[model samples]
Target: MKFEFADRVNRLPPYLFAEIEKQIKEKKAQGVDLISLSIGDPDLPPPPFVVEALKEEVANVKNHNYSFSQGEPDFRQAVAEWYKKRFNVDIAQDQVVALLGSKEGIANAARAFVNPGDRVLVPDPAYPVYANGSTILCDGEAVPMPLLEENGFKPDFDAIKAKKAKMMFLNYPNNPTSATVDKKFLKEAVEFARDNNIILCYDNAYSEVSYDGYKAPSILEVDGAMDVAIEFSSLSKTFNITGDRIAFAVGNKQLVGGLTKIKSQVDSGPPVYTQKVAVKALAAYKSAEPPEFLKKNNQILSERRDTLVECLGDVGFPCEKPKATFYVWVNCKGDSMEFAAKLLSVGVAVTPGVGFGKHGEGYARITFTQPKERIIEASERIRKLFK
Candidate 1:
């Protein structure tokens, strides 16, 4: 039987990583020993304490039931405490909503706020979910706020101010570009959102993944950010539990309420057992300093980042060592897809920049999530091919 997808479903762009996975499969089927740097998934295991806590939680039969759409009260409190301790920002339980993942929270937040024909300000060369997964699904027009290399891969607020939009999405310690921002810039974002009455969706998923004494800030750290912004943070990167699907949205009670309402209709919140484990994970933060587990994790990632960047430069793909995140955004200097294909042919896979957005056309993003030795191996493969 033949069937057709809805117009909105048809309008959705192909998920980029899905294409990468397909390529990996094809290469492996042909006997290639592919080293994939295409995805940001962490290769590290969750902390031992997290695993032990999960074991304890999973043993409780009471945790088998569906969780509140708003989240378990203790989990919300843990989120609030973490925000306070990490950012010195105050967050109320009412202002927090647990999510299966920040991906879904972001999409559902758009559902709660965006209407057909409404315009959303999205950064070009960003995580596609802000545009494809959220704005387009709501039939909203996505105005590209290009993050040009000249501007340090940050949106031109001057250009952004000129356009009217109902919402804007910004991610720092950013995914594809690995751009980092400070409170001063976040203040500017808050001011822009407040002046324009735009709902700012701040993706802080990579906030805990910074290196070299650089720390990422929450938009809520800015005064009055709670008036117009909601921040999404996930334990996936921090605790290396991506598959556990534990994340939360905080700030602006009304906005949180709206997202919670949307989630209630669509699905239950994150698993109760997972939330219990996440509570233990969040408890590891007693101060502004990251826990020992995270410090050690970041140290390893920093090592890998250094090795990959140096090797990429050696292999004719010169790029800056990003201060944050596990990605190196290489200047392909040509067609990104072609560059990625060349790497794939050599059994090293990286994400094509064009798959991210039009502004990303001449670059590719490589992840340093693998061990340092593996990263060196991938770069050696590239060096051989490029030379």
Candidate 2:
């Protein structure tokens, strides 16, 4: 007998990054020296204190056992405290649901909230996980809320209201687009969610990776937001703990409870040692000033963004300089996948925007995750190809 596949799993568009990885492997096999600007995985190391804490916790036999499903109390408290300090929003430990990573929380949140055939509002050119999680796992429909350059990549309230979706996914210092929502936009979104009886799922993974004196605001900062919003944050990008799989969801108690309940049935909490280390990470993050290394890193990437913009302009593929995050959402002159493939042939790896959504057609997402010298080299190579 042949094995059967579930319809939902079969219906998901090919996992974009996996396809990129395959192409990367093929190119490497062909002896191509690829300069990868495809994914946003950070290249930085976690703070030294975090590493030391992990070592200490691993040495303690007590930490070898399973942690609580909702995570270690200290970890939850630290997350709550960090949110209070960072966003100035008071949240209780019960309001926090620690996750192995925000991605898992996002998927589990959809499973918890979305019923079959429910409409989920996701931004166009948004994070792919939002739609995939809703559609593939929750049996929901994703109604794309078009995000355009004209609107500063912010969702149009009227359009979203028309959809009347049960849940809306909002990401700022946004992935792919690198668009940051201002306080006004966040307030408007909160009001919209409340008025529409919608659950606002805010992905704030890049909240701490900002530059240009612009701080990313949490949707929870808006008044009454906690009544209707749940914000997911990750130490992945912020503290360079991507491999640690430590993140949290904080907001409405009921929503957090729903997620926690689902999580309890599915898996045990993140490793006890990881949570112990996370406590130290959060504490260090609270007291530590921005280090000179990150300052220089951001400056270098900022310059790379400018250089990339100029280079693309010279090649007639102009793009707006993004204010935060490491991605540049480029409007490809024609088909996104074709352009990406062409670039890849030349040993440059960029993510095709169409892989994000239909609204992402004719665009590509270029990440500045590569080293500065490689970024400059990639820009030159891309310029030569286009010119």
Candidate 3:
């Protein structure tokens, strides 16, 4: 019997990371030693407290059962308290929902709100999941808003005001671009959402990963944000527990409930043990200052960012030293994919700009998640290759 894939699945865009992984495997098979600065997975371990908390929770038989669909009560309260402490914003337990990861929450938020043919506004050169998860997977229309260079890779909100959209996705400490938004911009975003009656999905996953004393602002810090926006945050990037899959969606009770309804139909909820671990992690964070291990990770990432920027500059690839996130966006000038292939062949892997979106064309992104030594080595290889 012949089986046809669903139309939605048929039209799915190729995942960029998969292609990068394929090339990496091919090179490894041929015995080429590759330094991968392409993927953004954090190289640090979760703090000792996080591990101990998980271990302690695993011993409790109660934590082995199915958790609440919204979130465990303790976990939700922890999130609320953490938000109050970190961002000086008031969030209620009722407005919080547990997620497998911020990625899952992002995709599900689109699924919950988007109807077929409804328009979704998205920034180009963004995390693919934002546009793809909202528009393609949900059978919605994608209105591509270019992230202009002059605007520092932020979409022109004024130009988009006339466009009718059911949802709009924004990220800061932005991925691919590595730009962070100020509170004024966030206040403007909240105003835009309120005026347009659009649901604002703010991805704040990299909020904890800033550099050079730069602090990323939470959208909830803006006035009226809770009335118009939902913020997604993750311990994956924050505490280096990417594999642990613990995150939460906070704000707008209705949207939180909508996502909860969709989640109930799809699966039970986040793993009980993981939710327990998350409760501990959030409590530990809000209770005091960041641990030395977490601070050291930021310091190391900052040094790596500086090294890559300087090295790339010496090789004629001028990059603005990113203030946040682990990625450094570079202009490759011509045929980003071709240049990426050339770099890959030389055992240095980087993401092609075009792989992100049309706006990302002629640019490439490198991750600072690699060790400083490896990043320096990749930069040296790039310098030698280009020279």
| Among all candidates shown, the one with the greatest lDDT | 1
Cα lDDT over the full model 1 = 0.92
Order of all candidates by TM-score, from best down to worst? 1, 3, 2
Q: Residue-wise lDDT of candidate 2 within 1-387, one digit each (tens)?
A: 998778888878888899999989999999999988898887656666677787898999999898889888999999888887777889999999889999999999999989988899889988889999655678888888998878988889976554547898999989888888888999999998988899999999988776776778888899999999999998888777799898989999999999999999987778988888878777754433444545665776788778777888789887878888989898897899999999998899999998888878888999887777888899889988977
| Model 1 residue pairs with clashes | none
Against the true structure, candidate 2 reaches a TM-score of 0.95
| Winner by TM-score | 1
**Candidate 3: stretches off by over 4 Å:** 286-289
The residue pairs that clash in candidate 2, if any, are: none
RMSD of 2: 1.8
**Error at 71, model 3, angstroms:** 0.6
List the lowest-lDDT window of 10 residues for candidate 1.
Answer: 156-165
User: What lDDT score belongs to each candidate, Candidate 1 first?
Assistant: 0.92, 0.85, 0.88
What is candidate 1's lDDT per residue for 235-288, written digit by digit as tens? 999999999999999999999999999999999898899999989999999899
